[model samples]
Target: MRAADWSTPRLGLSELPVIEVPNHALAFGWSSKSGPIRRRVDDCPVASRDGPVRRQRARWAEDRRSDDAIATLIVPIEVGIGLRRRPIDDVNAWLDTDVATHLEG
Candidate 1:
C-alpha cells in the first residue's frame, strides 16, 4: 500500500501490490494483525477498461444457502494497467470508479 498522511484515509491503501495468484489457489490463507483468515475465491473477472476489477470471495456463513457462495464484490483502484499520464485527482477518481466496467464476465 502507498504511504499517506492523515488527510485522506480512503486512499491510504491504494496501489498496494500487483499479485499474480496461481490458478490453483482455490483456497488461500493469510495472516493479519488479528489472526489468520482463509478465503476461498471462485472467480476473479477483470472488468473492461472503462470500472474496477470484480474481486469476489466465497462465503462460508451458515445463513448462506444459495447455490452460489460468492460474497460481496469489492472494486479496488488499480493504476499502471492502461494508458499512462499525469494522475491528477480527477483522473484518479475516474480510474477508481468509472474507468473500467464493461468487460464480459
Candidate 2:
C-alpha cells in the first residue's frame, strides 16, 4: 500500500514511522518485508477557554463516525531519537541573550 493511504491527519509527517515498530509485534522475528501492517490517526482535541472539551461541537455526529472508523484496529510503533542533552535549554539560552532582542521588550 502507498504511504499516502496510511497518512494520519494528526501526524504531520508524510510517511509512516514503520521503522519504529517493534519486531515482537510481527508474526516473524524481523524481515525487510512481511507481516500485517496497520495505521491510524485520531482526531485533534479542541482547546478553549471553556476548558478541554472532549467532544467537538461542530459536526459532532459525522466527526464521531469518522473518528471511530479511523480508530477501528491498528497496531502502532513509536520511533524516536534520544538526545544526549535537551535542545530546548540551549535554544532558550541563545534566544534569551542578544540574539533575540525582540523578546526583551
Candidate 3:
C-alpha cells in the first residue's frame, strides 16, 4: 500500500505546441517499514494513457505483476507465517482498482 507522486512529463514535437501528450513514465513507491510495496508505477501521463489504451495496458501490466507477485509470494510464505500476509508487488492491483474507480465515476 505505498505510492509516489512523480512530476508530470512533457511530450511534443520540437516546433509544435498544440497537442499535449500525457505523462508516460513509470515510478516506484517505497516506505521504510513496508519494503517493495509496488512497481511499474506510472507518472501522470502514463496513468492517463488509460483513456485510449487503458484496458490493454491494464491487462498486460496486471498479468505481468501478478506473475511477479506470485513468484515473490512463494518465498515469503515458505519462510514463515509472519511474512505470509505481507503485501508485495501490488502495483497491478492498485492500478486496476484506480482504473475501475475512475471508469465507474
Give the candidate number with the greatest lDDT: 2
Ranked candidates (lDDT, high to low) = 2, 1, 3
lDDT (Cα atoms) of all candidates against the true structure: 0.29, 0.30, 0.28
Clashes of each: 5, 0, 3
lDDT of 3: 0.28
Residues 49-89, model 1: lDDT tens digits: 21233222223221132444322223234544532232234
C-alpha lDDT of candidate 1 relative to the true structure: 0.29
Global fold similarity of model 3 (TM-score): 0.20
Model 3: CA > 4 A from native:
1-53, 70-105
lDDT of 3 by residue, 1-105 (tens): 101211111221133112223344433422221212223232111221212223334454455456543221111122233222222233234345544454344
Worst 10 residues of 2 by lDDT: 45-54
Model 2, global lDDT = 0.30
Model 2 clash tally?
A: 0
Worst lDDT run of 10 residues, candidate 1, spans 30-39
Better of 2 and 3 by TM-score: 3
